[model samples]
Target: MVDFTPVPALCGGLLIGAGASLLLLGIGRIAGVCGIVGSLLDAPRSPDAGWRTAFIVGLAFSGLVGFALAPASVTNVANSPPALVGAGLLVGYGARLANGCTSGHAVCGIGRGSTRSIVATCTFMLTAGVTVFLVRHVVGR
Candidate 1:
């Protein structure tokens, strides 16, 4: 069974919301991580590279901080490194196809009342639910 910690979840949600809001308010850019990383890869010397690098670096730093604060909470459920890498690649591809990641659609787009983002976010959630159900129940993983 999964351990659900409401406090940590709430805190994480708040932090994410705040970060997204700050990015939009401060730089007038959506906090879509995939787009940021893609932009960096496509144009390393672009004018916006500084903020993109900082945002990506901040994400990595935050993960390190989380692991340092609660080592037990940083556990990886995936046992195979290849599987994890494949999953990451698939997610990146999906985000590129969808034009935005969950953060950009669900948080920032929904906040701005975007119809396309709303539909995309719903589709994302539905797909995720079905995938999890199939993997855990049908596949007995």
Candidate 2:
């Protein structure tokens, strides 16, 4: 049966926002996964690599810890490896083309009152809604 755990979800959202806020305060950088990963790859000798690498590592480590604590709650979908890879590639490409991602545009950008971010976030939400509808209805999940 499905469960509605609003407390955990709210706590998680608060933690994410707090983490992003702290990152912005400490390093003046947006805590966007795509931007962080992309910049890490783009600059081989950049000093920012240290923090960026640490950030990515921390994200992975957090997921591992969460999964360890709640194995059943962790997502273990059975999608094909190739399909996952293709989706990852498409998402990466889209993030690059969009100049930011959900984290950057929705969280940081909205906090900063950016018009572009608002537009991007709205567009992203609309597109995601349509995609989900199509997948669940037209494409049969």
Candidate 3:
């Protein structure tokens, strides 16, 4: 019943893991998007702001390059601008509340064997399942 394409998924996971490993090994930093972007926005004059800015811009540029390289890989998921904006706001709020996003908890923190990250990762999975259930069944969407 799994609807996912495992090869692509695995490849993406490996890339993410490699990226995280490189960040950790090279600069002793966690490759958490929320934290990186947050630090850039919250403290533009911080000593590490240059790196953070470069990281964020590199992310955006990578996406743009990917889209240009494979337009088929970029499918519109039927989301409006406002809906996307609201989702971004919610994600930012959640990141602040949890002190990190899924990448930080599931990848870096869990890799470090942090108890808090494990719990947060589990919570993220549970919440995702519940949201899907409600969306597909309860809300009839």
Candidate 4:
């Protein structure tokens, strides 16, 4: 059986929107994680890299804090932690290759009236649905 929490989902969406809007309104920058990380790596001389690093660090710490508060909230599937980390790295690379993460493309991009973002968001949704279906039905592993 599956466990779904709509409240958390909605709250997360709202936070993402607020964060992206804050970044745009205050710093005049896009809240795309891949872009921010890439820029920090490739353009280390840029002044704005500090805030970007802080943002990424905060993101990492949020999960740690969440687990500290409610350890059960975290899940461990078939793979080990190292395997999951490798998968995450691959996904991050894929997101960069695709030019944006789901939050950046789906939430911020769509809200900004971007056609490319719209398509990218739709693609993300469709791919997610297909992956879930295949994992649950076809594989049954």
CA lDDT, every prediction? 0.90, 0.90, 0.89, 0.85
State candidate 3's TM-score: 0.91
Task: Give one digit per residue, the lDDT tens place, for model 1 in 1-141.
Answer: 988799988998998999998998998999998889988998999999999999999999988998999898677685589978888998999988888988888888898999999999999999999988998899985
Candidate 2 ranges beyond 4 A from true positions? none
RMSD in angstroms, all models? 1.6, 1.6, 1.7, 2.5
TM-score of each: 0.91, 0.91, 0.91, 0.81
Model 1 segments beyond 4 Å from truth?
none
Stronger candidate by lDDT (1 vs 4): 1
Clashes, model 1: 0
lDDT of 2 by residue, 1-141 (tens): 899899999998899899999999998989988999999889957999999999999999988998899887677667799978987897899998888998989988898999999999999999989988997899984
Model 4 agreement with the true structure over 5-80: per-residue lDDT tens digits: 9999899788878888889999898898888887788888888879999889988898899999999878779878
> lDDT per residue, candidate 3, 10-112, as tens digits?
9999999998898899899999889998878889999999888888888889889999999988788787899789888988989978988888999889989
What's the lDDT of the predicted structure labeled candidate 4?
A: 0.85
Model 1 error, position 29 (Å): 0.9
